[model samples]
Target: MTRPDPADLHPWIAGYLTPYTGRTRQNATQYLRRWETWCGQRGTSIEDATRTDIEAWRAHLSARGVRARGIGAALSPVRGLYLWAAQSYLITHDPAHLVRMPRRPTRSQRPWLDRHQLRRLLDYVDHAGDPAMRAAVHLWSLCGLRPAEPRQLLISDLGTYEGRMSIGLSYRKAGGADRLTVSPPVEAAIRAAVAGRGRGPVLYNENTGTALSKAIARLRLIRILDAARVPHVTPYGLRAGFITLSLEAGVPERDVMYAAGHSSSAQTAYYDRMRHTIRARAVHELTDWLDLTGTPGVTPMSDVPATLPP
Candidate 1:
């Protein structure tokens, strides 16, 4: 019996996955390419794959310093390709299904900047060399806008209605257009930053006058953080701080969800947990109650007088 050529499979897979070309296809292609390389080194074809072969491959990946999540992601395309081949009657069974993915550890709650740190960071941005960078940081800190969303913003997006400045966010991931009423301070910052620049991307490279990339934004943020000597702060951390501060200020969760462009209320819940304001407020109230009861010197519950006669 002759073996099928793996080179012939690329066009078929690409054609089948034409609808998923952007990031998803790119990731899948990377995983598939790695699998092909592995299989070539072993002198095996997809049709000749077996469960034992998959287990050995998993071990090989683990030995190569692949983390559990990376291992899972690497195997995902293999599973999909096997299923596709099975569905097309090119293979008798899907060997990829026999490969068990390692369990990934649960991630801890995300971190957000506290109110004091947030204020300091914004002040630092204000004093930064680039005015556009200052405005961009201000928007992210104040409005909880995603990094990429602000990059695509235009001057026309900022509109004034009933003496209130509002910004329209059209390309949101939440599948609808939403508008945020810019705070007076933020609007002033943006106007001052873009004073001479005509309608285009609001956030642009200081040197090139072109729209900023995520890498450039990240590098600029690192420079700002290093110069200010602020530790553990990222651009996303500023956005998280905006959400946390809003929740602490008694803003309703649904309203925060809208402003943050969160796809679900669960994401808002995560932000609430990170805020820690509710816990702090509860402790404050408890301390106040203890103080009002004339228990300042009390050590523990055992020190309290029992209401029942002893």
Candidate 2:
């Protein structure tokens, strides 16, 4: 299929994306262009697209082995395009509105570091010669940043919010601007990483002295874990560990959800259920019950709810 000319697409795309950020506008344009290419193959344009056409296009992509999430991403812009066009009176109906994308598959709990593994990883980063790597590790282990989040930080993004050190986050996968509050140690590492650079991205390619690529960040994590003699884990595992450790240490579920940018309590609870500390505490309570009464009938002390403070 021939690609649609940008000259023909630019005017409509510009108006549709006026409210989006630069990055979002770029993504929307890419997604829409892919749709346009599909339409071109079928001898139609998006302006004449129908619900059936959209559904067939979705099926075509699925037949090509596109994952459910990718199908959703591709369709979202087409939906937006029709909505914008309908609102502008360029089209009488929004065909893309009723077109359904595939349901996202449920994700299982991902792997993460335990206390001993995390401690060793942090120790290695702390002693490493590179300031940028130190900041990257601390952001992962302490502040619970997504891998891409740390790499996207700019010098101007650092600030004080409510008397706590905060990092402005603009590149969240879920979208929207947000902030991450950090402890003094993490803040210090961030400052050290940005030292001698007053602007632009904070995380840098150690060799290129430019913003670190996502691929490079993942590879870097593997090397860092190997050097520290810790077992292999994903950068996402660092984030999961942060949430797990925080909940296990009795941080409120709501607070953990907010800090970790989780959209719901259910997601936060999922991490809580996976924390090893909860099992350890339960085992200790059972041991104590057995030692005290030599009875199998006694409930573990951990099963009792704590009294509220007056």
Candidate 3:
């Protein structure tokens, strides 16, 4: 089948994406604009874009100092756009689909805070200068929430059962919505943070009580880590610490998966990999079953004859 004209794209795409295009569409548009600029600079029409052109663009991004992962992120939208255009018959050939995405480098395992470090960090936050900042740290460290989750939390999200506290979290993950149940310590910190406030987000600026931005979360977390003299700690590190601590404390993987609202088995595996305690335990169990050390009266490897006795 012949490809449709590139000029026919705008209207069809805009309508096709209407229902799905809130934050994702906005980001996709920005990426598409960049792709357009690159094509224009090369004196190529959008319809004339080819797999080679996409590959060149990936190389160009890398040459301009973009990281492999960043290149992958930027190209993701372009890939989607071409696929969508193909599906709508706006393009006969999906050049972006033919193009190989840049390989993402393996990220090092994030360093999780030990129990002592977590305690120290929490203690510092408990006495920090700004009440909101203190509360933010408490929520992340104690409750194991992603940085943005706390800022999105509402008053009605909190629940109590038999005097024990818990939080109901509605969070966005893996292109979908998932919910989490917060632990008691996390609930207590949240309650303390918003004792007087009636509604809206739980963690906010002390001066305005407005939602916190990702940048603000990073800055505050960095400050807290620095004050506690904990190295290599990010907001995500706190989450990893929580998973690690939970597994160490004998929490089942299934329970952790439910509590964290993980949507996929792969995500659960990633969490397990991050928790060294689980990895260690797994190795120990395997080694015990393997019986690497020979039993009594059994010849060790060194004691065995070099050649089999006839």
lDDT (0 to 1) per candidate: 0.75, 0.80, 0.69
Quality of model 1 by C-alpha lDDT = 0.75
Model 3 stretches astray by more than 4 angstroms: 1-16, 19-22, 105-108, 161-171, 175-179, 271-283, 290-294, 306-310
Off by over 4 Å in 1: 1-29, 42-111, 156-170, 173-179, 270-310
Write the candidate numbers in order of decreasing lDDT.
Answer: 2, 1, 3
Using lDDT as the measure, name the better of candidate 1 and candidate 2. Answer: 2
lDDT: worst 10-residue window of model 2 = 1-10
> Residue-pair clashes per candidate, as listed?
0, 0, 1
**Among all candidates shown, the one with the greatest lDDT:** 2
Candidate 2's residue-wise lDDT over 207-290, tens digit each? Answer: 887988777777777888889998888877888888888877788889888887777877776656354657788888997877
Q: Would you estimate the TM-scores of all the predictions?
A: 0.68, 0.72, 0.81
The total of clashing pairs for model 3 equals 1
How many clashes does the backbone of model 1 have? 0
lDDT by residue for model 1 (103-148), tens: 8644324466777877777788777776677777888889988777
Report how far off residue 175 is in candidate 2 (Å).
Answer: 6.3
| Candidate maximizing TM-score | 3
Q: Clash pairs of candidate 2?
A: none
